[model samples]
Target: MNNHLSKTIKNEMFSHHYQLLYNLNDFKPFGVEILFRSSLFSNPQRAFQKAKELNKLYELETTSISKAITDIHLNSIQGQIPDHLFINVYPSTLIHDDFVKTMKNLIEQTSISASNIVFEINEEELITDHYSLHNAASNLKEEGFHIAVDDFGKGYGSIQTVIEIEPSYIKMDKFFADEIEYSTHKQEMLKSMVTYCEKIKSNIVLEGIETPEQFFKARELGIKLGQGFLLARPCPLEDL
Candidate 1:
């Protein structure tokens, strides 16, 4: 495909694709998480990976952010906007020089409060420059935007990273939630993290919850927010 055609197709894909997030407490609508989908890829993970391979990950992230903000404004006009919108951003992308500037511009353009949007950082990738990451995070926080470290425990020095970034939210990786009913170690780890979060005043969000058992287990462990199939599945804004 030529450059112009590819750009047009990508723009169209961004327009039609996105998912809604929900609160686990009352199962009420929470926010939207932008997703990329097409005939060539069945899921956002695959599509994002392809973008990375093509060295277009930054462009993809920028487009997703813009589209998400626009969608939220449209929903607001319809009186269907939620509490917070979660946008998955790569750590590298967050650290870019123009990243925060672009975010400010989008917030201004959409008339969305920075506090209503949470930048969910994927911690699975190695963050070699902690200083840059910390700087970017600090800048966002100062701007009143919330920050979350996604897939928390699965990454390197996650606890340390959490301390450094001082995220407003920490999403517990699903691996810990997989079989907590049977795994004593997982239960203890979660309990410990909960205690840690309490000390830091950071909220916890358990992801990938798929069963009633898992949902109850997470609740028992004092997880206030959660995202999973049991509580709610991803859907378009109109469906929400």
Candidate 2:
């Protein structure tokens, strides 16, 4: 077989897991986050690491995005996919060569508008110059796509990124939700974050809410969006 066919076969082995993002106010569905999974490897990060070793990280990322568009279409699931699809991607993928052209090509083949696709950036990297993170975000924005910064308070992502990128959503890491009910400190920080997010026109997604106490605390802190075991668990889009 040709190299293209080999690569196609490799990417086709990858599939995606979906989780819902919800409206805290009305308890209605707001959107869904697409998490990439691979049958070949039990861990998703290991798949990406293997791709990196093979110099195929871009292909891996691209394939996942394409699969998300058709995931429900090809699945037995009867639920309509939510408009906003928050796709988790590496920061490196966002800055890859021809990334915009490639993503536009993938999105053009589908009925979904580019506006409905939000590229959620995770992992950490040193941001340098306007042409780095800023440029990647600007290019996507120009094409009607959106950006989201993942792992807000933990990992390498920081408040500076939120201020600089001004992403449409700020996903707080689950660490804060671990014991949120009893921690006045965590609650206070969340309240401050909610205010800060409002000031910049960004929504805060409080992740890892696994209990009523944690969920209630998140709601009381004025969080607008949330995702965790309490609301729903991650499952294959086919199961939706």
Best by lDDT: 2
lDDT of each: 0.78, 0.80
Residues 1-240, candidate 2, lDDT per residue (tens digit)?
235434644649766788998888899989988887766676888767667667777877887788778665444245466878898777778888688998898777766778889998875544444358778888899999999988888857477777778899999999988899999998999999999889988899999989999887888889979999888888977565
Of candidate 1, the 10-residue stretch with the lowest lDDT total is 1-10
Clashes of 2: 0
Please give the TM-score that candidate 1 achieves against the real structure: 0.90
TM-score (C-alpha) between model 2 and the true structure = 0.90
Tens-digit lDDT track for model 1 on 109-188?
87579999899888766888899999999999999999988898888768777989999888888898798778889888
* TM-scores of the candidates in the order shown: 0.90, 0.90
